[model samples]
Target: MTNEQANCDTMVADPVVGDGCRRYVLPRQRPGDSTGDAPRVAELKCKVAELESQLRDLRRTNDTLKMHVAKALGLQLDSPIPGAGFETTRGGKAANAVAVSRRTAPGAVRGVETQVPKPTETPTGVEFRVLGPVEAAVAGRRIDLGAPKQRAVLALLVSQVGQPVSVDVLLEELWDGSPPPSAITSLHAYVANLRRALEPNRAPRKPASVLRTRGRAYLLDSRMVQVDVHRFGDRAMAGWQALDRGDPQRALREFDAGLALWRGQAYAEVADTTHVAPEVVRLEELRLWAIEGRCATLIAMGAHEIAVSELAAFTQAHPLREYGCELFSLALYRAGRQADALAMLRAHQKRMAEELGIDPSPALQHLEREILHQAPSLG
Candidate 1:
């Protein structure tokens, strides 16, 4: 057939024939068209189905092997053995029985089903909000974490994040240096309760145990959960290093997010109650550093007006900090309020001299001279 006839046939024909008229004709396709990978695609899909079947078999075998190993070692496995489905009875007679379901498909692997039965429920990812009351994510929902005491325990663990919290240390913090006779049992109960609350469905069959007791201490598996305070500190430390490395843009991004994590005081209600005073001090210091880092980044970015308000608040909170005072003064001076900046420096210097019996640091003095446009001695 001619090219025009072929084109007319393609446009109007319901089912076109190939050039030889022996095979059905198909539509044109590009090199990267999804249909272009038909053979490889089919092969991959078959391979995936095969691998999935193999995986299901391996999981069943592993489950059995785990049980055997647990029995041999006198250790308990974290999951239940595969078994029959649950059956409910009425009037001493089993009726409307629900058969245990398993997913089966063609080419299924031997000694393994295509899909093993899953529990009716499973543990959802745990949510931790140190920005506010420590809350948990259970079953894809948020639940009230616990009472003040429990929250304090959670906070202690969260504050340390990945580090192990010792039993003695926890007892001391929980009881204010004097623990009860059954504190150990109480701690165990608390951990169990937390696990159950965090994973209600899995609690009975297989518990979600993030708190592990080893030797004399308990470790909270921070990797499996999110903690806002830990995230803040980690980002702030990285931001500080970024600043040292002369990457102010990235540093600003990090410090901004880190400082924003502070909804209120670090550990707010539990700070004083838990012997987390040292941690409180550390976070407070980091908070200041984060704020300073932000101001420095802003100044480096040439955002004088934006840094003014933050610097003002920071200087008020930390009048003795020479760097903060200097930054505030420079921000004000750069914003064309030289007179106000000079007054601020003098007021802070006077306060420092009176309160700490020391004058402002040389850095502050040098900044003041620079602000006043005065020439300092070269030698």
Candidate 2:
């Protein structure tokens, strides 16, 4: 067929410019066109469908293998894994022409949007864990959290987690009350660097859905990211509730899971910084509480031997905390070491009186009385 008849079939559609020739696009069938084209188009469509199925399968297999590798190596990376960047480039015009050729024939071109619509982004599972050193992982790959100051900023944001932190507070904590005039500008740069690392695949100029701008404040979107500190809190709270509801087995599992997630001290890298100090202190306390709760749960399950072993060390390490001492003594008593238990409580009382010139809480005192009287409920 001639170039003029090109518009008649599903073929080339090139509009010639600066010429007097006018192209009329007839959704017209080519003179020799018949029923054969339908079968050809259907076959091509089936091939595309088959290719899509294969692509999905390959992706799943890739994910499973990466997961296994990540687990086997015990990787605790603090940086984004390289070589996983998505191909955001769209199909070329020729590829679009191919698609049009295979289906309905090309029609007279009116106008098309010049900008190619980018592919929808895949949701990345980015996990930031500050339970130990501040680190992050995306899709089983480590993400470098940048320099110390940047990591500190991340810790501050993670401390507030789902809440917005104003620019002033971040600045105050960053420079420790003596910020340079360029502190705000520097802070923005740090955030930009962090966003790049955290979202390596995020489109340019797109608003960050994870680390977001909220007026004058910036908030980490809690829904889009996972924070190990938050996860631990959730598990610990669930464990406590389970214990209260008389489900020691489930409680033990939850407590153990939360405890296992701790890599080291909370905010270890930035522990000295003002922004992280309070959070470090608070998480450390919560960890201790979780330990005591687990120990208490064990005792309730009549595992006095285990409770004695754990609480003895816990109490010895934190002697000033009467509750640990109380639990230790109780566990000793239940383990049939009545004299040892009484001596332990008496020693604590004597030490408090002599060292601090203060008395133990009433709970400890009451425990002593109950032990001395051999209260039936103590069983």
Candidate 3:
């Protein structure tokens, strides 16, 4: 068999990632070749399209079934209890009623299928966004979060949603460990105002739902609220997992979706407080990792020129970061700028040694060697 036929045969059988060692290029079709690979690839493409359509349909059907199940389970909650003046409405109260029945009248829902989502499940009610400013939106409508201190409190709880925050911790964060005689009272007042803003429709004298009290501590319930920080984390993790699985296309898609959630600096209203500072820095670092991963996946998918354009500003923004330098060098090498790639690495090495008094990392040094030889594995 000719070389073109061998290339065509390999391209048809191997995935685009191809064992993570080499690029998988489809050869041009030759005249009068009996291999018939042109039509074979088209046939495989058609099959893939058909399978993808079927998968989408399956997902839609599954979603429809889940909705039907939710409706069926909620039907019992919608009915008024005997001699009890519960409103026959469909909302938080209905969901609460299910919990009540399970606890008080266990036998009633003993055999019933429960669909009450756990606290970790993302809710459709209130979404707290700390990726940008501390903001809350209830069903697409943004609410007024009272004062700066109150927003800082929310930001602290949002950074650690579903966990209890002690009153002492709250006071320290709010007042910087210098509490006035009226400090506790003022904190109570702030929490009251926050509850009013967040759960405006919460009935009077009923325990505060969204932001709840636990002895001397308070917690923002994840079950009742959705957070963009959590969403970004999930998407970023998924993207990394996809990249590890040699699916750069899916990785890029996930990274794009995740990074789009960031509007500005994390916890912008309360950037460097005692409680919020660590989380703010950690989130920013995660954002950087996701961005770097995105560029790596782009280069892995043979879009090295696009990666080069992206990493140019990233390297400028974070020149001392060895991983970013390594990625930029690899992207340059893959984009066919072999000389430029070596120069970029050497420049980074100089900056490291001059400014930080340290040599480049072993990985970066190895990458410089790889680019010098135009290693086939750079692809």
Candidate 4:
């Protein structure tokens, strides 16, 4: 065979061929060689082509699923996923997008003067506060959310705002898998009471606008209500992105706005409850991360004293957190308290050895060495 033909045959066997298409080259036929293998080679090539097609289809499906999972987990992707704007029902069908109504301007009256509206009136719609003890306000009025169990139900719905939650899942969460005989009936009553409380003006038998009913499930329309948790997440993500882009001032503002939404321990009222506990923990961690981001921004802005004071209380609250220790020590060192910085790391080392039977992390140990030698980079 010619050199070019030999090279082609070698390239065909390689798996890393570009454009995701496999090139199959049949071996060159010799004189008096049997032609019987030609059909078999062609068949093998067909099978390879079929397999490649299937692989491409699978990759496409995987990418689509990844986008969906990211969206479900509250991540913003650079490219929008198909059908993301629509909510999916329990029956695996996409529901129609909720329509947002636009207000029309009033007609002009030629002979009458128009009075400006007062700013004291609170805007309509439900406002949810889940950063602390769960609270809901509708049209500026506090809602009587009923007993603990009922509130727990609302909390679950609020956590997954705009997503349909199955009745079975709600039952499992509410009763911890040991529901009573009347659990379904009780749940219905609670939902009815919540509907009445949230929509006092809805006529009997009319469809709900805020809390919607899907097949075997319920969904809280996010557009009809405002959730502080979602707002905080958006701001926190923005802060993180700003910090990554080297805009510490904007990062600080975003982090402060997000952190200020927290009134106290997140979901403190329902934290003891089984189902909401995970969500509470997740939100609390996010809150701490925001605080850390804010402190990092302050340090970047040369406000090391503020970071030292803030991180002092933060490290005390979370002594075992290595990032907290690193930031705190760095802040002290930058604030001209080198001795305090070294002392903090020594204390951390001792505490870790005594409490957890482990040595300090590599980052902490490196910081300790840096402080000992008065590293110029510590500045």
Candidate 3's TM-score: 0.67
Clashing pairs in 3: none
Off by over 4 Å in 3: 1-124
- Whole-model Cα lDDT of every candidate shown, in order: 0.58, 0.64, 0.66, 0.66
lDDT of 4 by residue, 179-278 (tens): 9999999999989989998888889999988889999999887668887886787677677667544566788889899989999877766576665676
lDDT of 2: 0.64
Clashing pairs in 2: 10-105, 78-143, 78-144, 79-142, 79-143, 79-144, 80-142, 80-143, 80-144
The segments of candidate 2 whose C-alpha lies over 4 angstroms from its true place after superposition are 1-123
The TM-score measured for candidate 1 stands at 0.59
Per-residue lDDT tens digits for candidate 1, residues 54-171, read: 4455456545654663443233344433221111111112233211111111111112221112123334566566664556665458876666777777778766666778889888
Please name the candidate that would achieve the greatest TM-score relative to the true structure.
3
**Decreasing TM-score order of the candidates:** 3, 2, 4, 1
**Per-residue lDDT for 234 in model 1?**
63
Which has the better lDDT: candidate 1, or candidate 2? 2
Q: What is the C-alpha RMSD of each candidate to the true structure, in Å?
A: 27.1, 31.2, 18.2, 19.2
**Model 1: runs farther than 4 Å from truth?**
1-124, 138-140, 180-185, 201-208, 241-250, 374-379
**Residues 1-379, candidate 2, lDDT per residue (tens digit)?**
6543443333322211111121212233457756466754564455456545644544454345435433432223332221111111112232221100000000101111111121223266878888888888888698888888898888888777678888998998889888999999999998999889888889999888878889998888776787787667667767766654456677778889999999998877668766567667767766886887687667666677998999888988898866577778878887899889899999999999999999875446646776786654456
**Each model's TM-score, in the order given?**
0.59, 0.64, 0.67, 0.63
